[model samples]
Target chain A: MSWSKAMPANPVVAVAGATGAVGQEFMQVLHDLDFPASEIRALASARSAGKKIEFAGCGQVPAGELIVQEMTPESFKGVDIALFSCGAGISKEMREAVVAAGAVMIDNSSAFRMDEDVPLVVPEVNPDDVSWHSGVIANPNCSTIQMVVALKPLYDIAPIKRVVVSTYQAASGGGAPAMEELYSQTKDFLNGEELKVEVFQHRIAFNCIPHIDVFMDDDSTKEEWKMVVETKKIMGDESIAVAATCVRVPVLRCHAESVNVEFSGEVSVEAAREAYETAEGITVMDDCSSNTYPMPGLLAGTNDTFVGRLRKDPTVEHGLALWVVADQIRKGAALNAVQIAQLLLP
Target chain B: MSWSKAMPANPVVAVAGATGAVGQEFMQVLHDLDFPASEIRALASARSAGKKIEFAGCGQVPAGELIVQEMTPESFKGVDIALFSCGAGISKEMREAVVAAGAVMIDNSSAFRMDEDVPLVVPEVNPDDVSWHSGVIANPNCSTIQMVVALKPLYDIAPIKRVVVSTYQAASGGGAPAMEELYSQTKDFLNGEELKVEVFQHRIAFNCIPHIDVFMDDDSTKEEWKMVVETKKIMGDESIAVAATCVRVPVLRCHAESVNVEFSGEVSVEAAREAYETAEGITVMDDCSSNTYPMPGLLAGTNDTFVGRLRKDPTVEHGLALWVVADQIRKGAALNAVQIAQLLLP
Candidate 1:
């Protein structure tokens, strides 16, 4: 079921859900990466149709405004790559049409992530997973994408046995409206007005919510479950056990994770640092003397997955602990999707 | 040597570092708990000597302003219990004077915590640890205090083999000035002004700092080290291993922890919930169906250690995960100290 036709030298790319947060990031990342797109079309729901979105041009596309189009089956007629950031329902609704139109959909939704024929890919970790994709290439969860980017180098060093992670996620992971809620709620909180929480389960201003996404039947949030199952799928290691507690903090953009990894054999802090230093798409920001580490507030628009606070965990026989941070919208979402699109090039 | 004389029914209480954050909380908690203090002396350094602090009526002490006194060696002459929240250096300096004058020093600093003679006590977890204290009984670190409270009830159900905890600590844990910094910096950040970070190493307005205290030689922060050592000492189980990554979050008060505990035996989520329901000084707030879990923003000023998000971690055998939150100043500091004082009563 792999792609039968070779992708053109310059693909006609469609940015689905263009008016949304990650959709905008998708356009920016394509320009930043200098992706060779012959024509770029902005597609969204009927409500957002005709909205003008400014685009910094990339490849053959001119630098100007892109008029939003209502996404429909005919929208993908000449599209070589459809970058989907719409919800899962919309993605599932348009999947067959997208495939039949001879366009490869790199989906940001969770719809086909666990499907047997669909490829769940993090370009830095599993770019080869893109080769076998049957029309739809699933982008891993934002949290899982950054984690696996940081974990791949380590996994190459030694087989990881288990991971215990607790995330300090950002509002950006919830999309544009959630970020707006954080901004307005913060203003209200500071002004002594009662905070109105509409986008989150509770007021996200100056607070930490232990729940992210919907709660699963097993009491783990859907986001937490995604990290567990996605890591196994993307890393191509079913034996690795992950216990995740995903929490949302008030930070507007970058998501940080405190990860403790236990390997099948000894992997020293020095070895891990060296692995990260040479690893693709990973920047090491660990230095205790200078008070330097990757902070979420200051790392909003970065592409690399930043790793820091590397130390040994004496509690386990073969363990190392580290802190990871990356822009949830950039490396965690948009940049990773763009990288996957890069792998689809001829 | 343990206290030689029996404590009077109404002890003369001294609030050292009276002008500091935890010192103020100590006073509030004393009144809140209706502690039987015959006379409450507000003691501070020479700079704050003449300042007055308002005290609510409690026991023999009347509701009025108590003039602060300069803390000299003679300050503990008639004091029966000296609740010290001053820095570790000052606590060490005043330890001998308070103990020589026959007053038990219940210190909130890290001064004598690891000292063999000083018994680190969390009253609910190990009230008996106070029995053999040689003059000074140490209150555990704020992060360690809440975690052990949550762990105690679970441990009672089964022996915990290991614990991996990541803390979302509040600005209040840094003292009064830190809370002030969070308030001002957040305002400054919202107003588009450069954040002034004085109390913390970096901007903590909407960021998470992985380093809490000074970094140890092994690269783990001192705050993380305290959680590891203090938990073993307070739990009276040197066999229990702990790995902690402590981070400072933007919340004004109340520290929240994501704890993953692996027990030596099977402990179901139902069994763990039952243990927490009957556990003293703990409140279980877990209900995924109703979106009910303990949140740091809504749970300020609470004395109980709030436990929620209870679930099974299939990653390991006999594993259970939970989220714990407590007012860092109350149960983590002042209230816990007062509870220890209650243990010292005749």
Candidate 2:
């Protein structure tokens, strides 16, 4: 049940797509957990090989390049856990290969999220579901992960029939290219030059982009679709009716969502506040009397999903409105994957 | 029935409380509108006297001291048009006095908005309401003014029933001292120094403050109250049920709102789009295909209320979600007041 090379017994960890943003974050998180690892392998496409990354603030020897070695049954040798953070295509191609090689795969992609056997884990919301993963565990989308982390506790108190959320997502969720585009577009606009947008479909400087991913036949993007489906899976209710309008803001790191949840019965504001206060992995910063609520700048570099602006929705009989913010790179991707690895650690 | 004497001759214009943020904006805007003024009287409290301000854009005239004069009946003697940008107390103190002095007072404070006598005007939404003002025109609250401007066109095409809005208000809505506090607190947070909060009840640096103004018995703040009442007054419809959550974000100038509106009849998203396209004082920017949407930064320094993220609220039968952004200092306060003055000009 372990990937220990020597009988002395220390875990061997493998980081798939280790050079990407969240992938790099996963490495740092693992070292921060002081994961009892005898060895660590930073794997990526051959294109990113020999790229050295320094793991500061966490235990690290110099990071080695991931060779262009094809992921196969033999690739998971001596590895107890494989944290997959590359794109969905790579995860889909190699998920079974790594798992068949006898290592547990904690994937930070959307490939196997709907797979009934592959548990979609947000740890705080559904750690018990992790036991059901066939071989690979799926990480929920960044927006979905933060929201359900806050919504789960509330949903348990009263059955949530509907959720309407509008997300002010960050550039990090679009990967390093959109991050570079944000920086470049901002610099261009600041310099009085025309903004050039490549990664984004439009100019992202000083503007909110409503389209996060390509639209489907229903006009909902893939990102919004993830929120709708993933919430159903994580909350263990397919009838949970969720609708989302995903937007990308100029913010650099944290993603924010303005969420309104309607329940089956009357959920008073005070009761909801207390529920969030006691909720794990969720921080209730709701203090409107003194003007303190959750925001992206405040949630940056934090693992806890900050939830605030909690108030009763006067529109519906049993409705609550809140603003939730979390670091997409951390809790949404890296830290969640690392948590799964820690859970599976011998 | 014009206020300008130029036609007419020359209109004597006075800017009450002409030293504050919107007051200064009043003077600039008066000149920008080519206000037919033989004399411009700059009035403020005794505290802000002997301050010479040159209205360069207003024909490069050498400005005199900001007179330390009480807003009494006699002081408003020759003012054919008196634009009042003073506090609510000042408006209450001088409204009758200015009326007796034979000057039409356009007060930009909350003292007279709900009053049946004073007609609240957004011009874009209810310009005709201005004709009935009994020597004292009421200016709607900043947030309310912008919301109604965007909602007016939509309401005409489809009768609106309920409006649920959560505002991402700017620091400028609270005036200059609050802006100073925002900068100071931000620097303090960055320097790891003690955060100083004076105007706002809480530290607004890297945070969202949900409470604006005093709280009402209903647990909503005075701000939320003003939006509800003023929208009714300006739109001339008390039947529209409205609820608002006013939030102050760290943003300096523009205020953004996430609005969910429902109508009595089924209105297609395309119909709402058409209504916005033809609406005056509004710029429709709802192209979600290319990531184009309205944002506070782009709306700043402009008078138009920019709206985007136009989509059918999948949860409701005739509901649509919209994001509205406008420069609070300009369209929400200064420019709006100035535009009202423009209507009175020759």
Best by lDDT: 1
Count clashing residue pairs per candidate. 0, 3
> Which digits, one per residue and each the tens of the lDDT, describe model 2 over residues B1-346?
3333232246677788888878877776766666666777888887776676667334333444444454555779878778888789988988777887777888889888888778888989887776666787877888998899889888898788888787777788888888778767755755579887789877776555567888766667899889988888788888887767777766677888878887988888888888888788889876545556777755667879998877777666688878888888888887887677666655
Question: Each model's DockQ?
Answer: 0.90, 0.26
| DockQ, candidate 2, vs. native dimer | 0.26
* Candidate 2, superposed: residue stretches over 4 Å from native: A1-11, A34-38, A51-75, A115-117, A175-211, A215-221, A250-252, A342-346, B1-10, B35-39, B54-74, B176-208, B214-219, B250-252, B342-346
Model 2 vs. true fold: TM: 0.85
RMSD of each: 0.8, 4.8
- In candidate 2, what fraction of native interface contacts survive? 0.29
Model 1 error, position B340 (Å): 0.5
Please write out the lDDT profile of model 2 over residues A128-234, one tens digit for every residue.
88766667889899999999998888887899998878777888988888888876775565457888778877776555556777776555678988999999998
**lDDT string, candidate 1, A154-204, tens digits:** 889899999999999999989999999998998999999988989999989
| Model 1 regions lying over 4 Å from their true place | none
The residue pairs in collision within model 1 are: none
* lDDT tens readout by residue for model 1, B1-346: 6657789999999999999999999999999999999999999999999998999868899899989999999999999999999899999999999999999999999999999999999999999988898789999999999999999988988899999999999999999999999999999998999889899999998899998989999999999999999999999999999999999999999999999999999899988988887899999998899999999999999999999999998998999999999999999999999999999998
